[model samples]
Target chain A: MLTIHNLQKIYNGTTVVNLTELTITAGESVGLVGNNGAGKTTLFRMILDLIRPSKGEVLSKGTNVMQSGDWKNYTGSYLDEGFLIDYLTTEEYFKFIGDLHGLSGGDVVERLAPFTDLFNGEILNQRKYIRDYSKGNQKKIGIAAAALSNPELLILDEPFANLDPSSQIRLKNLLKKFREEKQMTMLISSHDLSHVIDVCERIVILEKGQVVQDMQTTENTLQELETYFTV
Target chain B: MLLTLLSHQWKAKLRSSIFQKSLVLNIILGLLILYFGSIFLLLGFGLHKILGNMYPGQDVVGIFNSALLFCFLIDLFFRFLMQELPVLAVQPYLHLPIAKNKLVHYVLVKSVPSIFNLFPLLVFVPFMYTSVMPAYGAAVAIVWVATLLLVTLLNNYLLMYFKRQMSTKPLYTLAFGVAIVGLMLLDYFGVLQLKAISETLFGAVLVNPWLAVVPLVLLAGTYLLNFYYLKAHTYPEELELRKTNTATGGDIAFLNRFGELGKLIELELKLIWRHKRTRSIAMMSVMFLFYGFLFYGKGKFMDGFGTLIFVGIILSGMPMFNYGQFLPGWQSGHFDGLLTQKNISPYQFYTAKYWMMVPVTVLAFILTLPYGFFGYKIILINAATLLYNVGVNVFVIFFFSVYNKERLDLSKGATFNWQGVGASKFVMMLPAMALPILIYLPFGLTGIPYAGIAALGGLGFLGIIFRKQLLQWSANRFVAHKYKLAAGYRQS
Candidate 1:
């Protein structure tokens, strides 16, 4: 479970994020929707502690994640390639991240075994470094490595942007399966409303640093969510 | 459109926080020195004497015209060698509505106004004016010089545009080396009769002043030619085309000699190789050989067996010994990975460095031997000195990193640092030379003649032979000062 209480972020002396009292429980899937500059990415980064919040706490269960009190050892994220080291091979990178999370190399290989040949094993011995990987392939690799951790909390920012439609659908299904199997909690942000609609159960609409609407997907179409987005 | 692109490029560079602060300070200091020093040096006593000796019978106008042409050509040579393609600004416009040819033209035109184009003209014009034009009218003098400036700008821009497109280090090296050799050969042959050329060229400054238009025509033709080449090959971001697919591990036959230490040395060498600018250090490794030649020859300016032996050690060991002076910064990006590895011993790292220097020093001594025309004793001393670098200097310098403050720009021109290299290694050399003398001096004077030299050579040989102990001990000291090392890595 994650809780963001009175979270605020300022940029160049102006408050860009000012959300108040948001929470999601374990196994819950949340779609964060906002127009450009509506602070979805900023909120995710503050939660991951990549950036410090201007005010208030990003809490996991009862502990403040921001104070360096406890890392969501359970959290895996790719806000951008900042989480990935490009010098590494896709396999080397996944193994290194797995090691960081205290998984053995064998354990990582076992988890990745099912999907290793999915990209025609073109990736495994491709000898192509991450920097040379196509934009979509890089996204796939980052997302795959994040999922490889079997994290309790997985957060992805703009996961569908560079992905081909098939990969996008495949990723949505995988997220669904992971949430069902491990009861994982996830926060995914995307500008493409349909990807969010197809995958996410509950939607939290943000506009100008405000959590303007929290609605069940069955109750409204994505178009109904836009009134909340208007500045 | 071209002006807008140029302005945008200028403003973008100016707005970059790092670029603005650093470049402004760098430019201001450079301009101040260039302006003041040129004036002072122009006023210095050597000018009239130097010009007079060089051009005995030639009138000043002939001298001035030739000098201007010569400087304009020099300016073009430099622009080819040193100019940077502003690749970043061109990227965004590539997919825009603008025609690629037009964009390329804008880039080529924009390059003409760079600071480098102005430098030679500044140095030549005023000095030539006062020195050369006393016999000519101001109208003829001013117009002739303006023609020179126009030609310099025109040709300089064109040559650079082509060279920038074909930029490769080895090509530059070969061309530059050949150019230098040609210039030297020309001087040595005394075939050009430069004094006459100087006199005629300056004299031509006065007679009708019409011939000065020739350099301008050459400039315009070359610029048009450059624009054609640039348009055909406008690979926008090619300027930033740093190769990332650097072949790791030893595929080369010579690298197999090093074993694992060889692999590491290979990796380090590859880093130097791939980054062409960084290899300036290795090339400079060759320059270090010249120090002995400066002091060692029998009829040379400063001949001494001891000085030659001393320079021998210096030429070989100084760079590697000096390298650790910027201890942490070289290891900056990989510090987290390197530090967390509890498996590899620090001595492994230290010894690998020694192995790298072994070949470095072998090359250094072999290069230094031509200077051994002084004696075979010098060759023997030089070999002993190479071994000495492997032993004593390598040990102390690794630990010298503990107090070192230089966080070298690993990304910058690797061979040179104008800010200043550290003094610890240099200070350490005083004792490296003198302490062995302490052991050698009393024994040589009182008992066996040349005993001091033998003892020093013996100690150097043994130190290299017993380098394991030296490496082991330094590793411990380094571990103890690990915090400082970490801090140093972050500094660069």
Candidate 2:
């Protein structure tokens, strides 16, 4: 459903991202691996239309995402904390997003029904202003909101870092369940190759803003990815 | 090292547009303050004109002494309140194989060139030179001015030492705010009996110029005591936890009162309270009030100027003053989550903001009401002005919220204004000024008190009638300006 062709970005007169062509079919779970500042975020921004690329276009379902009203509805992202409004409680935060996606409160609760215990009264009526929340708690609330929209595309940046191991596993399972139920497309980026290796159908390694390798996760596994990372 | 510190101070001063503007404006403004100050001296001139010659106590030295005490109080207050104690410069030397006391002394020395020290001299010297110089001769005027400076400096040094001790205590922010406000109120209401005190002090200074040295002993005593406190209580943890707990008192109170809005307001309040810069609402208000005093008290004017002063004093402190100036950037970190999920309308967002501004406007009114003793009808005008402040001014500017966008980093020094305040304040002042004129002009010309009352009611009713439309317009305007405001706050 997502497509990128010759997506080039330049900063300070030097190219940071120059993705010649890339596409993921609807519902496909694709993983992007990259060096730090390898233009993964720039790519993500292109996909979200947060920043402009110097050339080329990113399209979702044959429509250019940068120009499409449908893109905001179909896509969910957690890449920028500046995108977060600290004045809101987690509950109000979730409610605002769901409303934007035209989801009813009941639908939101039904969606959240499974994760109540995991959140552990830690987030309920957790009226603590998000500004006062710990980084991990903010991460928990952000991840929870992303899944609440039940969108066709979900993109996460370093989603596993602040999360506890158990919650990370739970997120993996939730992503799995969503993929099976809705055939949702996921673009996930992370430093922990092992975490994505088990979940992604295909892996693409990005080094310095260009794809160095693209292969099936079945072929690389965590060990091969580890070897690639170390080398 | 001293030169480096002074140059750093100058660099910091030069970098600020406000400081630069003030220096330029003050040259013009200084002449005005001095020229107007001469009028007070001309009260003695008027006395000279009236009683055939210079009568004892015929001049406005009473005003000068009153103003001098004002200078004294300001220096003392800043010495207590400002945390720019130059501890950072010496932070590099803390590891230098130097004794802590020597390091502390260096920090203390660095504080003398502060903006606080400059203000008194700017104020007193001009008045002394213009008023007393020709009358008493330049040498006597110079002595009088220096005597006043030493008095202010001695108080400043003592307060600095006092702050050294209090920084060790709990609830220092709250205590500092309370003490300053209390002291200011005492001075403001003239309960300090300033007119008599000044005459006595000037009489003393005239006889024995060396008597000014008595305050120096007190200054030295305070400095030594404070130096000892800093030396003995140099540990970090002594004052840390108290401030942390002190911040929570407002949080709980706000949460209890505001309900959900209270929760949001509490977040906003805590943001301001935590960041000394955001808490500068009081400072901004006082500045507005102080500005009004300069224009109002500088002249003995009729009702319209009084109305302007009254409104100026009250409305200048709109709670939303700088808080909502940045619109949504105050929510920078968590906005994504709020944007992504749940369901909040633009109305709810703007509603919370309107509610927050209410108390500040109310407090501003209460503060201005005392000027009624100057004239009771002026009090009525101020009360009418309060309604106009709310209905015409406060509401109109709520819609203007997008323009003057400055995201205050609460942690930044109140003086550190990197956040670029856009042209909204300049634009907003037009409607705030114009609407009041329109509302009052017809009634004002008639001199019918009821007409003024009717004008106020009519304006408020109009605001209430159109509040929904204004809010809708505000929401749309804010949404449009979101990205611009957001980028600006982050940049600042």
Top lDDT prediction, candidate number? 1
Per-candidate DockQ versus the true complex? 0.02, 0.01
**Candidates' TM-scores?**
0.57, 0.51
B1-492, model 2: which lDDT tens digit per residue?
445435434554454444343344536545766776665455444532443344455565545564456556665666665635543343222211234566556656666665566555655666666567767777777778778766766776666655644555536545765876786687669787655666678656755767766766766776676667655543333312224333344436635675666666666666656655666754665666544454343344644543553454245345445554555655654554545445455665676666667667767767766665556655565666665655556566666766644444544555535444444555665665666666556666777645866677567667656777877777787778767766645433
Relative to the true structure, candidate 1 reaches a TM of 0.57
How far off is model 1, as Cα RMSD? 18.3
Quote the positional error of residue B112 for candidate 1 in Å: 5.5
Candidate 2 stretches greater than 4 Å from native: A1-231, B15-89, B96-102, B122-148, B169-221, B226-228, B231-242, B250-263, B269-317, B320-342, B358-392, B412-423, B442-456
- Model 2 C-alpha lDDT per residue in residues A1-231, reported as the tens digit of each score: 988888888876778888888889988898888779888887887777656678899988889865544676667777745445555667776776676567799988887886675576687686566656767677767767777777788888877778788878877777777788888889999887877876688898888788888888785467778888885
Per-residue lDDT for B275 in model 2?
59
